[model samples]
Target: MEEHNIFSLIADNLSQFYEYTGFANATFGHILMILIGLAFVYLAIKKEWEPMLLVPIGFGIIIGNIPLFPGLSVGVYEEGSVLNILYQGVQQGYYPPLIFLGIGAMTDFSALISNPKLMLIGAAAQFGIFGAYGIALALGFTPAEAGAIGIIGGADGPTAIFLSSRLAPDLVGAIAVSAYSYMALVPVIQPPIMRLLTTKKERLIKMKSPRAVSKKEKIMFPIIGFLLTAFIVPSGLPLLGMLFFGNLLKESGVTRRLAETARGPLIDTVTILIGLTVGCSTQADKFLQWTSIKIFILGFLSFVIATAAGVLFVKFFNLFLKKGNKINPLIGNAGVSAVPDSARISNNIGLEYDKTNYLLMHAMGPNVAGVIGSAVAAGILLGFLS
Candidate 1:
C-alpha cells in the first residue's frame, strides 16, 4: 500500500509538472507559429537574405509562441516582463527614427546628388502606397488601418513599423512582417517586373555616368534636404530630422566616431530590439488570422504595384529624353527603398545583357531617393491619419 501510494504521488507530481510545461499549453496555432518561425530562420540562413533582421525576428517568434501556462511574468505580454520593456520602444515608435539615423549616417548620397532626376523615380514608386490605400479602403479597412497597411508598399520596414505603430498599433506586427518580407524578396519580385516592362535594348542601354559630386554639395544636400522636407511635412521630423542629422555627421568631415556609433553598434542594437519585439508582437493568437492574411495579400500587391510603377515610370520618362540621355528602365525597380540589394539586382540583370553596362551606381540614385521618399510618404500618412 505504501509503495502504491508513493507511485501514485509520483504520477500526480509528474502530471502537475506537465501542466506547467509548454507541452500542456501548446495548441495547433502555437505549433504552426513555431514552424513558421523555424521557416524564417531557415530562409535567413540558407537564402542569406536580410539575415541580420530575420534571425532575431525568427527567434523572437519562437520565444513569443512558447505556450506559457500563464500567470508567469516571463512572457512578452505579461506585465513587468523584460520583453515588455524592450517592446515599449516599438510600441512608442522610437525605434524607427533611430534606425533612420543610422541609415542616414551610413548612406552615401553622392549617387542621388549626382543625378537629381532619379529622385523622381523614387517619388513615382510611392504611387503604390496610395494604390494600396485605395484598395484597403475598398476592402473595408478603417482609414487609419489602411494608411498603416499602405506604407508596406514603400519597401521600407522601419517606416512601415513606424506608421503602423502610430496609426494602427494592432496591425503593427502584420504590417512590419509584410514590409520586411517584401523587402527581403525584392530580388525575386523585381526582376520579373523589370523584364516584363522593358525591352532587351532598354535593359542594355547605359546612360552617361554620374559626375563626381563635390564634398561641399554632399554636405549641403542633407541640410537643405532636411529643411525643405521638414518644412513641407513637419510630421516627418522625427525620422527626417535624425536622418539628415546623421548624414550631416558623415558629411561634415567631422564626428566620425559619432557616425560610426550611429551606424554600427547603435543601429545593430536597435535592429535586434526592434526586430525581436516586432516578432514577439505576432503571438500566435494575435497573428494567425484572416486579417493578417488579407494584409499579406495587400502587401504583395502593393509591392508589385510599386515595382511595376517604378519601371514603367522610367520607360515613360525616357520619352522626352534624347536617345543617349534616356534612363535605363532596369534601374527603375530600385526605387522601392530596398537599398543596395535592389541596386545590385539592377546591376546583375544589366550585366546579363551587356557585361559592360554596370547599373549599380545609377540604380543607387533612385534607391537612396526611395529611402527619403518613403519617409516622406509615411509622414504624409501620419499627418492625415494620426
Candidate 2:
C-alpha cells in the first residue's frame, strides 16, 4: 500500500510540472521577452512615447506573460482567451478601418485642396516605404513581412496597422508600436534630417499665401480624392475609403452629428480597445526576438529616408517654380503624417527663421498628402504580397 501511494504521488507531481511549463520548458527567451515588454511600458509612461498607446501595450505584455493562465496562453487561438479575442480583430483588419473613420472625421483637407501641387510632395515622401521594404527584404524577411515593415515609414499608425494586420498579422504589435512611437517622436526625429538636408537660407524661404478654398470645393475634395485613390489602388480602399469618408463627414456640413460622433465617442472607444489589444499582443516570447530589434532599427531608418526624400523633393520642385512661388523647405518635413503636430513643428521652425513666416497652412498640404501616400504605398505592397 505504501509503495503504491508513492507512485501515485510522483505521477501527480510530474503532471503538474508539465502543465505549468507549457509545451517547451520555461527558458531565458521567455524571461527576456517579459523584460522587453516592461521596457516598452516604461518608455510609454516615463518617456511619454505615445502614453495612450504605450501604457496599454505595456500592461498587455505583462498580462500575456502570466504563464499557463489557461485562456491567456501564448499563441493559443482558442475562443475566450485574451489574445485570441484581440488577434481576431487584428487578423481580420477590423480595428484600423474603424479607427480610420474617426481619423477621417478629424482630418481637415482644406490646405491640400488649396495647393494640389503639395500632393506631389506627399507622394514623394513615400519613397521611404519602398526604400524600407527593399532593405527589409535584403535583411531576410519574406516579401509579405517586408511589406508590412516598410509601411512604418509612412508614419501613419492606422495605415501601418491595416497593412500589418492583413499581410503579417504576427508582426502587427511591433510594427504598430514602432510606427506610432516614431510618429510621436517626429518632433525629435525629423528636425535633424531637415536641417542636414536644407540650408538655413532655404528654411527661411517664405512660401506664397494659399488661396482660400470655397465650401463647395471642400465638399468635393473628399469625393474626388477617394475616387482617384480607389481607382488607382484598390488595395488601399480600406484605408483611403475610411479616411475620405471621415473627411466627407467633416466637410459635408449635413453630417455634423455624425462627424461629432466619429471624432469624439467613436475615436475614444476604439483607441482604448486598440491600444489595449496592441499591448496585449506584445508578449515576452514574441517580442524579445532578434527580429523585433531589426524592426525598430529599420523603422527609424525609414523615417530618416522619408524625411530626406521630402526635403529633396521640395528643393527639386523649387528649381522649376518661379522664385516668388517657392515653398520653405522646412515645411517639407511635415510631409510625415504625424498629424497637426508635424505641421506645427515646421511652422515653429520657420518662425525661428522669419517670425512672420506662417508655414502651418503650407506644411499641412504635405502633411495630409503623407497620409494618402502611406496608404497608397500600403496598397502597392498589398498588391504585390496579398
Predicted structure 1: lDDT? 0.92
Winning model by TM-score: 1
Worst 10 residues of 2 by lDDT: 69-78
Model 2 lDDT tens row, 27-60: 5765665675688788878887777766776666
Candidate 1: tens digits of C-alpha lDDT, residues 1-386: 99999999999999999999999999999999889888889999999889998888888889999998888788877888999889988889989999999999999999899989999999999888989999999999999999999999999999999999999998998898888888889889888888988998888898899999999999999999999999999998998999999999999988999999999999999999999998888899999999999999999989999999999999999999898799999999988898889999999999999989999999999999999999999999999999
- Measured on C-alpha atoms, candidate 2 has an lDDT of 0.83
What are the lDDT figures for the candidates, one per model? 0.92, 0.83
What are the candidates' C-alpha RMSDs?
A: 1.4, 3.4
Q: Could you tell me how far off, in angstroms, the CA of residue 223 lies in candidate 2 after the best superposition?
A: 0.6
Error of 2 at 50 (Å): 2.2
Q: Considering only N, C-alpha and C atoms within 3 Å, which residue pairs clash in candidate 1?
A: none
Which ten-residue region of model 1 has the weakest summed lDDT?
A: 70-79
Q: lDDT score, residue 82, model 1?
A: 94
C-alpha positional error of residue 78 in candidate 1 after TM-score superposition, expressed in Å = 1.9
